[model samples]
Target chain A: MQPYPITAMALCNGMGDSTAAVLAALRAGRSGLGPCPAEFELDAVVGAVPGPLPPLPGSLERVRDTRQTRIAAVALAELQAPLARACARWGADRVGVVLGTSTGGIEASEGAYAHAHAHGGALPSHYDVERSHALDAVLHLARVFGGGLAGPAYVVSTACSSSAKVFASAQRLLAAGLCDAVLVGGVDSLCRLTVRGFAGLEVLSSAPCRPFSRERAGINIGEGAALLLVERTGEGPARLLGVGESSDAYHMTSPHPEGLGARLAMERALQLAGLVAADVDHVNAHGTGTRQNDSMESQAIRAVFAGAPAPAVVATKGYTGHMLGAAGATEVAFVVDAIAGGYLPASVGADPLDEALGVDVVTARREQRTRAALSNSFAFGGSNCSVLVGGPA
Target chain B: MSAPGFSVRGLGFWAPGYPDLAAWQARPDACPEDQSATPKAELLPPMMRRRTSLLTRMAAEVAAQALRAGGLDPTGATLVYGSVYGEIRTTLDLLAALLVAGEPLSPTKFHNSVHNTAAGYVSIATGSRAGNAALSAGRSTLAMGLLECAALVAAGEGDVVLVIAEEPLPEPLAAGRRWGPFAAAFALAAPASSDMPATTCRLEQGPNDKSLAPARPAPAWLADNPCAAALALVDALAAGAPARVALEPHLAAGWHCGLGAGA
Candidate 1:
């Protein structure tokens, strides 16, 4: 196989105080989703961060310009000090920034718009053009590093595939000698828009999301960020072996029933890595729990790995809920963690796999050494991106 | 064994108040209309038109023009659509509804607000079951689109790929941005023969530093502008001569230049 090109250093998933809650859920094979008793009319399940968000530090506040940015700020706070030290060692210019987000500061925009309409006039001076757009999050990170002028800063928003696409983009950029290192990750905050939007789609389950199960229902809306520092080096660190990106353009809201796009994306990644289907040890399925999505993905997996023994499939969305744009990076972090920890976390809430969807869906935590894993991310508009992560060759 | 690369074959563009290619080329400095009505839905079938946002409509129209100019059908062709502000109007509307009415957001609008919405819609429209991709990199949206399109072609993913870029003048977004809204697309394919035009596009890092060089005459200056690269494509094809054009890099501080010449 052509060796995986990009390596990942220091991966972190920020679930606020809910990290323990989620970890428990993972250990107990439970889902973090529960009833939302909020004033909203919708009766839906939410994979909400278990507790209050950590307070932003004064240093961060001075630079914090928006609420969503602040959410991203908090999400990255755990890694900032370590990342800073790493940047110093790696040279700031060599480090690039690629952030995937569905709504960078949409929450802030909604707030500002509300304030303006109610009171008339303009928003705070800081709520400028950059803050309103999704790209601003990456720009903010670039500024924080004092390396805005040094390297590339990109923001990718391909809906649910946004964060996953960032991984692919980062790999390409690094492979092409664009940057020696890149901070490839995603950040998204819960906003009324996303919550109501999902509710409108009638895909939000009032109970904890059950993925890949006969009784599986719908997905829970959740938000947080996951950050991974990827470096192009000859040794050490978890290597990013391959990436496949394709758009189905099949439907705006629904995936193609045949899973043609998903299959193509997975096949492309394996081909890029010069490996056959059998090389993959684990499948981190998109598994959003929606009927069409889960069923379609199951068929795609069955088609790709058909005759050969299917890889153990697990869906992490049951734990983190669907982080939307951040889902790709957040799930990738889980894959990296699984590799680092030398175990595969059970597909929380998965039980009695659907009869029609023929695949070995992992339900209980299993301790197994994994050399390579494929992480799948499918977004609206049939945009599918898959990333292959593996141990160093 | 060599890596794949993109080669431009045909180009087309459409903008408000600019009906055709000739009109757009003649009025390079034409500003966007202060206000323009949305095109009538009858132009496209309701099933196809219902899902298209303003940006998607403009993109589809421009892509069709590009295919016609290239004398190719987009059927079974790969596609790449790039826009810095993807379906911003729809996004703004959704956000506004959430803020004011606290209403249930439209699922269609929410889904269509994604970066690949237009590309996906185009594929559905053309029944092009080939690869489709979307990219964005701030001001260099078109450049990035071109880069991805070239990579796909080189990779042997498809014989021909469509690269389309569109930005619409939503009053809110255009309020402070300098450039006017426009749509440009190109049908890029592998060279059919030695006589086909040869094209090379390269992306590099550094700061944009073009002022030191003396400005060329008006015609030459216009030829060098990156936006004019689309026009240079048409010129090169028409005049059957080699052409070199410079484009501002999307990420780097320097210029990204392309050189093409027909055999």
Candidate 2:
């Protein structure tokens, strides 16, 4: 349960392109979601990354070129210098890659389907399904393109909790001495499948999402990528103390009614981190703004810190939207910002907090020393993961 | 370099031609078209049973068999699932629906498309709250999956059921590799005293020469099946011999696994 150093980090999402930019926007109280375009044929607001994405370089285009890889390339480029230094420190063969994704470059498949229709049900030969749409798309992108990491490498795809679970895998690899350093990341880009799929489920909000508010609507889906370098000998101002995982064993797409799995994951994370409820300074919630998720998460937070004054809980989805697979890593980036900047971002858009919820939903920034924080990301099939982060001891 | 050692308490296998390890070992070289009663899936309730994809049913069936063989309790075990592509049948259906107008994509299919659908369903059916992980590494999937199982054992997770599955790939997506549906599960734990046969397993980073090849040649019909790599280890266990098996022959470098006698 010893803390691992976050030696280097790169983040690109609706909030901002770099960790610093994201932190700045968090401090300034800004919303990154905008109205969804008519082409999407959806009414909800979305967190689409603006501007151009860097193209895949050279032979990577043959197997790893896609919207997901392009989005990951943006963040991986920001992480180049530090990542390269770490990879050099530990030979490429000694570093591992564990990436999480919900729908890996699925936009390519959508295009392929349209192309198949035009060509009488023949998919375009130029596309590589394994490289682009499979769960390992980003794993190959980061391993092969992220300096050819040759150690243990794999991809985790458990819906929304996809990327957050990567940290657990990294922890195990480092704990087992399989790698000196591991690059753990998550990347999911917007595609017709998810946008329309959620629409069919009636969980897409026409207006900006409002987490934990009585008047809350559903989620505003987002797209982006976040990567972090964690080392066994990690020493720095930031640290990943622990990761706790659990399954609801209840339902797919729906959380346990009483937040049972969420509470278990948080309790397990606390156990791993060697911390008590009172030690936590803040909680970055998996507040997807869905009525079910917010209520369930609130119940879990209150239960985890029962009898003690629960820490300030903030939902930054208003800033980053719901990045789905990328939410965990990106929101954890927000926690790093808080640890370094000595302040907490208010739960943006959480106005007139829902009375039934029993947790402190921070409505304004509070400048304070945040020594430890917990970040929650739960996904379909009741897959739950909670990561503990804090300033160096 | 060898990692910490674990033991395989039980093993299970399912494929188009071979329904179980006994059948596979009996006729490894024969390509049988005999229709066996594919999994009855008695554990799954009626409503949930209707939603399972072929991949999920295949995995759950093998998982149940492994647990029964190992005489292990599902409550105390963790589930580790690996697949090159997960729930492709459900995903393809979702994609096709997306291409049409007015008709909404089936929410059930969309939810079932997750790579971990099998783990989730099996966990629920078995009442396993021990947690689960779903992963993939393309050709290196089985190797990475076994490594994860070893790591979990070393991390004090007690017992783990490692399930590796791959449903048949559709055209263009197959990319010219003619692999059929395959799924396998092995219940593993720390070396313990028991009357049942067990294979001592350790993951090592070394050359491929030490790897064991199945005594019976694999049927030529199914080629490049990811889960097929585990057959060598299963064969070593069936033979009750100490040997090294190549989890992945060509892709993941130095994934030579050693199996031997165990309690």
Best candidate, TM-score? 2
Candidate 1 residue spans exceeding 4 A from truth: A5-14, A17-44, A49-64, A75-94, A124-126, A146-149, B1-6, B31-46, B71-77, B100-102, B143-179, B187-195, B205-207, B210-252, B260-263
**Where's the lowest-lDDT run of ten residues in candidate 2 chain A?**
A35-44
lDDT tens per residue, model 1, A313-344:
98988877898888898888778777767888
Task: State which docking tier applies to candidate 1.
Answer: acceptable
Per-residue C-alpha lDDT of model 2 across residues A78-174, encoded as one tens digit per residue: 7777767777888887888888888886888888877876787777875778776777767766766667777888888888998898888888777
Each candidate's number of clashing pairs is 9, 0
Which residue pairs collide, candidate 2? none
**Each predicted complex: what DockQ?**
0.35, 0.69
Q: What is the two-chain DockQ of model 2?
A: 0.69
Weakest 10 consecutive residues of candidate 1 chain A by summed lDDT: A9-18
Question: In angstroms, how far off is B51's CA in candidate 1?
Answer: 3.4
